[model samples]
Target: MTKPTSETPAEDGAALLDDVERFHRRFNVFPHEAAYVAVALWDAHAHLLDCFDSTPRIAFLSPEPGSGKSRALEVVETLVPRPMLAVNARAAALFRSVSDPAGRPTILYDEIDTVFGPKAGDNEELRGFLNAGHRRSGVTYRCIGDGGNQTVQEFPSYSAVAVAGLGSLPDTILTRSVIIRMRRRARNEKVEPFRARVHEQQGNALRERLATWAKSVQDRVAGAWPEMPDGVTDRPADVWEPLLAVADAIGGDWPQRAREACVTLVKAAQVNDKGSLGIRLLTDLRDHVMVGIDRLPTVAILDRLNALDDAPWADLNGRPLDARRLSRMLGEYVTADGQPIASRNIKTAGSVLKGFYTEDLWDAWARYCPPPSASPLLPLPDGADTD
Candidate 1:
């Protein structure tokens, strides 16, 4: 209940974000501090969407119902500008909503798993819409009218979008998102009951404050090239850039906090990544199945991979990874000299057989996988140097 005395815009911005974070913590139990940080930044970012080149989708996903996924989106609804909450909305409707002339809306899509789930059976248009919307220049083309009058017209798909659902989304969408893996609240964990009639006003008040702050810093945010934490490059850099920029603009502990959240969440995503089976295979080969050996015959590799209790090699497509499949998968990768890591005939004992030399895989392993560390999968602790 204490009033904030800071008069400067930057100080006010930082204080406002802190208020947003606390509001979320009141009704929701995020898995980690990073999730809370990312979500708060995302809410503020939505008000300044035009100042950003890309808007990372904040996804709240859970493996089961009642994991607070929808509740997370509900909390988001109150904080963003022009919030449009949709469930089971058609692709065309979404397309029009984003392209509306008044202003692009912040899309809070719940039950997203249904649109991308097994039973959904390839909602390609919706997928494309979500993917394209990540970048500022993203757009969707549509044929207008009929017959001779028909012509393809481009509709702007760029907007701030957050989704919540049970299970996972497609890899394309997941890569563009700040994923929060929601979980069932523990017995000891308790949160205030959310009744929109009472709390919506509170959230909306915060939303207005955020909108004013965003206006005050719009130009600065638009031109910001915030320094990224070491090892955060490529797609992860692109994903965290805007949030980091917003943090920098707010000017407080937020800049440091945002980077920590970026590293922690990015590391968590890498650890739990289910998208790249090929990269997984390469890392497994380097760490587990093909260690300290110069050569491993295809049969031996297959046996080891299949024997792995935690790997998918044993039941890939209802059959263990065979020599042919192994060769096919490995052939997809190249060495430092730009040669495929394909099997070569190796003379073992008296017989020759197709196998991979460890030297051939060295380049691919180095480039594609993180170096072996004692706890590579663990999240970086707060204030830990990522360099």
Candidate 2:
């Protein structure tokens, strides 16, 4: 039977939502290397609106106070619809108003960290707002009681948000963000024009067109969400669920591509266990120890690992790395024939233990440690002349 066409409005909206790449190709222009980042942010923003509809994102770009972070946002403001630019001073009140039942705002806070970076108290203040807004939840607090005493009250609000900063933010913030690291601009490269359109009436018309189309396909955009891959099963159901919902509404290749994009983006911004102590690092350590496919005394292995005297980890403060540290670090990685080892410069039982390991770190850590050699032993000299 023919598959049913995505009949939902949200799904149709996903299908109708603007494909960012089209604009690039149409202009015969390729964004800088960070263009993929731009796409991810754009997709997140679209999903933000489609999901919460009124929840605005807080997108930030930071670089050493002057790597043109603000300038980048200038370009973004020019392109995005209904952009609300706010100085850090105005950010909290802007969010409070957005969270207010009367008029919720979608906001952009530029250089917000400066306000908090000065002291721990300031940091605490920003953290509260960030924690509260990172994912929309009902806000509750004490209100005045009927007897002129304080009373607790709480209310719900839907407000989508975004924030950007230099390097990285606190782990709490990172856990809930799509990070973009802004690099310093090159000497001779060019940046496109950035400005609010005044004379161009057509820009407004296009924005209206895009917004209109977005509103029309809301339901179908939601349907494709159920099919997203399993890796992200752990995230809160509130955030990406809606974003994926919008992606599914678009159906066909988009649902898959968008899913990939969503996962890739979030994963890129996150720090994983593999990244800090990955296979490469592990392999390098194993190589230093000279592990093979056999058994050896565990003490020998520790000795060899301790042999490192000048590796990066073992380097003394304010002193240069010495050769012993590097050697020691490498020694810790050595293993035996299917068993771990410390060193191999000695014999086991009646025979000399031969070479420590026949394979290198690259192969060993990929878990492809080589087999012991099977070459025939050399024969004794037949009849040497009397000395």
Candidate 3:
């Protein structure tokens, strides 16, 4: 996926993205998922150009084996600049390769689950590097040469990275990535077999075009700031900035597709994290939160929550739900600065106590939680939850 840097018209960046998408379609992937992978391919060359504060890592994950996760990476390897397939790359080699100013390798790290699995902490330095390298100017300082010539040299660690494996990566890494959850292909979904010779030829041709297009548009891409979709903020905003900019530079359906992909994928990642339990709680509390009432006292909230017949809260640890446990379970939605999200104090029951404001809960539900009406929280009929 590596090629020499060159120049092209700004409009060609879109064409390059289109080519990347064509290469991506040789495999069976969801429409938005393929769109994301195409963005990552363009990003692989964008490093030499002006980039946002963070370089979004493309994470390919699956629940089980043989889900085309690696195959997706293989397709990416052909089109990205200076591609390196390091399924088992040592940490030292990775650092040195990325530091190269002549050409930075687009790291396609396979089997990342094992790299960050139970023994991941054992390779703490490498893990730390991956996390730090997501941002521009991220560097690893190494002292080289003998005692007399020994001097600290800063190694540029920032580069485009694509990781593929089973299940999720560690939180630090996952949060910095454009995550694509792969699935075993359904019997009806068919794709061309990824024969090395044929695919490589196709991929290499696209790679050259990408290099040329990137050269032409690097200056504009560097200064370009594409407007992000609503609800995308903070780190998620930083991570997707490059992709959206590429889509904008490319223009047409890509811009719409990129925005849709950004919102859909980012929300999916947020909902999939530690907030799963909070999401469940939010789903059950929809009626109370969505009603005209702005706030409710903790006791009243617990009464409604515990009243649900099929809810686990009523018999948590063989005891009914209480203030302390309710607070503890829902506390996972706090902001990075430790501010509570979706739940806060309000003047209710004639006393200012901990409770959820309608606006706050609604924001959390819209951003980090899933559809509340997808399934009945209480499987029994509406009146059957009187227990």
Off by over 4 Å in 3: 1-11, 31-49, 119-122, 145-151, 275-387
lDDT of 2 by residue, 1-387 (tens): 122245523323333344443432222122242334334335434433635422323335454655655654554443455555666644345545655655454445566565554342246545556555554563534364687776766433344444545544554555555445555656654554433464124334444445555555555553444554566654423335565565555455655665666666555554331232233334334555544433333344445544665433333466533444434544555433444323354467786642333332333453532222332222212342334
112 Cα displacement, candidate 3 (Å): 0.5
- Residue 282, candidate 3: Cα error in Å is 13
Which lDDT value does model 1 have at 351? 100
lDDT of 3 by residue, 186-236 (tens): 888888888988888888887777666666556777888889899999888
lDDT for predicted candidate 3 compared with the true structure? 0.72
**Backbone clash total, candidate 3:** 7
Candidate 3's displacement at residue 369, Å, is: 10
After best superposition, candidate 2 residue 166: deviation in angstroms? 2.0
Clash totals in order = 0, 57, 7
Candidate 1 accuracy as lDDT: 0.88
lDDT of each: 0.88, 0.46, 0.72
RMSD to native for every prediction? 6.0, 11.8, 8.1
Task: Give a tens-digit lDDT track for model 1, residues 67-157.
Answer: 9988898899999999999999977899899989898899999999889986888999999999999999999999999899999999999
